[model samples]
Target: MARRGKKKGRPVSGWLVFDKPVGMGSTEAVSKIKWLFKADKAGHAGTLDPLASGMLPIALGEATKTVPYVMDGAKIYRFTIAWGEARSTDDLEGHVTATSDRRPSEADIRALLPDYTGLIMQVPPQFSAVKIAGERAYDIAREGEIVDIPAREVEIGRLDLLDCPDENSAVFEIECGKGTYVRSLARDMGRDLGCHGHIAVLRRVEVDPFVADDLVTLEALEAAAAEARPQGEPGEDGRIVDTRPDKERFAALDALVVDTGAALDCLPEVAVSDDAAQRIRLGNPVIIRGRDAPVEASEAYATARGRLVAIGAVEAGMFKPKRVFTGR
Candidate 1:
């Protein structure tokens, strides 16, 4: 058997809750974070539209394994809907498709809030990532095609009218489950009140266990990178010739990361002994010894010596290893 070649970059692991500025795509943010950390791998928990700003959690290296948990978690968004003109993409970037002089009163908007709350059927915007016949819905919409997008059930846990800045627009804060589209909510609300509408602004403030305090802006990240970079002159090859200690360089960048296990905080955790952890690491189920250990859980994580070992199903007295994490 031949040995597999090692992957590139440092084994940096953790979640970097990013304040993704408007106009930057989610993929671009992930790429930039990977380059900044010089990590072997990186990924984001959820995709934020290019026009949307706020918490887009980027996971580096081993933290990528926990992204699904964050993605499945509830999201809180603060957005403003401009009432009067309906747009093609359901946001400011789109072309105006329809127009009306009608603007909903505060009473009208408040009355409509109940309709948006709880489980509701939503048809995603035309310019969205939803797939149609193996092609992206946005692609089809771009070709000047009007495709019928079916409505799907989405749960909005809480919806509130935050402010009505003027007669033209109103701000709202919504806490919704996975797959809820704020753009759709805006569009539907406008339609209901007889005023065409589109998203004027959008920002995600929270994703379950993560929140505003967890966020780090791109400007701050660049500043930390500068502080971490060794004082050096460019070599003949144009690469930096370092004049800083290894520890100093690592500490600056590593400080930006929240623990990889932080993303799994919502899940039940079972702290295990080293011997049992080693067995769990090797794809074997281990008997969970403590009386307080959950007897049955569909999804749980096992940690040993403060590091994550495996995420698995706990049945009876056993913790069955499903996906194991190697920090490297």
Candidate 2:
């Protein structure tokens, strides 16, 4: 007995807070989830290296528009640094380039925390996604070229030592602004302490509005799909079953998807009139006159009838649509 092929996915929209596991690239994760939900389009807010794991916010359908906001938000990473060896990539996956026997004392590491905090100039690793000469630095490095990535100012809101498991390794957590690399931090900290080191384990604990609380594993999602799927009619041979997303399955998947506006909830919101919402949807700027209007906010989410209409910039009491959300 043979079953029919599955139908092409429909326009599914929302955000999925996926707890990505190690050894999975962000793109691969996105592809897997997209296939599972049969979504029309998908993307991720940030890139989690194959060596690192944790919250990877996947945007489906209309939710993809808010990816930039999530990417620019602050991120929290808890990682372990293995003392004694420095790697070419500043992580476990790369080749060892140097080694040292000395390990920094807890007090010594704590004493230097203030120096790493706030804004500091940090150099990115050679094997990085950073662009140089219109090409990826990692690609150039792979070609056996000397990649010199200059130091740039990055903000580290907090860097605290969590535990000292042993003389060989220590764990720490950090909350940093965009463009900050944990691998570079591990490498530089080791150099400062006279013990060459590299990142051994790295996991992102938080990204702005997203946290561990919202994380759902891929296995769990599969289970949800199976549980939601209605029993299919058995073929004459009883060896085949139809597999297609009915309304019930779509409802089940929708339960897991966060609203498209959830990513932009951090920003102030403005409510517009029915007439104004239509004008804004047409890319026209409208004057929002009300006490609830944002006074100094350069950007905000505009809603009408309790539904997110668009993201817009406000200036002199006028709200101009920047990015509009078209589909549900």
Candidate 3:
């Protein structure tokens, strides 16, 4: 079995899509995986709240450079809302600030959800990580200061009512763009229903190319690591074993780090000859041939001196340096 943090002596590139467990922040998950792989550099594509879980793409090494490519993709979440109550933080973590005797009907919620399905304006919660005046809005709220965060336009591509377990509990799934906040959405939905509501539970179902089905649990990860350890290693008592190291020996370091290039699958591949590859590696601009005329105008194709620049792809036939890998 392979030993983690073995100092393999060279960098490799790849992407690790994590099914982030609830109650753990995205940064914490990244740090843990980084230590497990013994990776020098690693970063996550987006931040998931401790209350939310799912589809956190961890980019290792060179893959970190491609994070911006997937940052704008849509995200899907499955969340539950408790009707007739409002919270200070707009979620279960907050203190209940308001309550009502009225409970919205399932049909009413279904009808109301359609109004939020398309382009909508949502005011972010005051107790949020959004930066205002160079400080987190939540920090200001925690200080008992009343902060008025303005509403911003956000796209809710899809909002489907999945279940209504009771008169006061409703479940729904939403597909939205980068900045959509489920907690805020719940709060606004309460306002729309003429009653109070707050998010009781939230789970990210998908983010672009990743989904919940791909998630690996912490237990599974530990098992994998145990299986990967070298076999027949003597125990403290001189007996051979087929298990992993003690918890104290499990270093909080990444054992397998991947390069950044593997993270961004959007870049078009442009293979170049050995000479041109060397030039491109050295940051020299090379002219590429056989590129389509329309591709020349694409933003992905960086132009220098009226010629396409090589952002990442290589030229196949000649030592041409100017071919744009139009991830097309």
State the TM-score for model 1.
0.95
What residue pairs clash in candidate 1, if any at all? none
Name the 10 consecutive residues with the lowest summed lDDT in model 1. 241-250
Q: Who wins the TM-score comparison?
A: 1
Query: What are the models' TM-scores?
Result: 0.95, 0.91, 0.77
RMSD of each: 2.4, 3.8, 7.5
Model 2 off-target regions past 4 Å?
1-8, 227-231, 234-246
- Candidate 2, residue 259: lDDT: 78
Worst 10 residues of 2 by lDDT: 239-248
Candidate 2 global Cα RMSD: 3.8
lDDT of 1 at 84: 98
Model 2 steric clash pairs:
none
For candidate 3, write residues 1-72 as lDDT tens digits.
Answer: 876774542143346777788899988998887766655677888788898877788876555656776677
Give one digit per residue, the lDDT tens place, for model 2 in 105-179: 899889988999999999999999999888898999899887988899999999999999998999999999989
Q: How many clashes (backbone N, Cα, C below 3 Å) per candidate?
A: 0, 0, 27
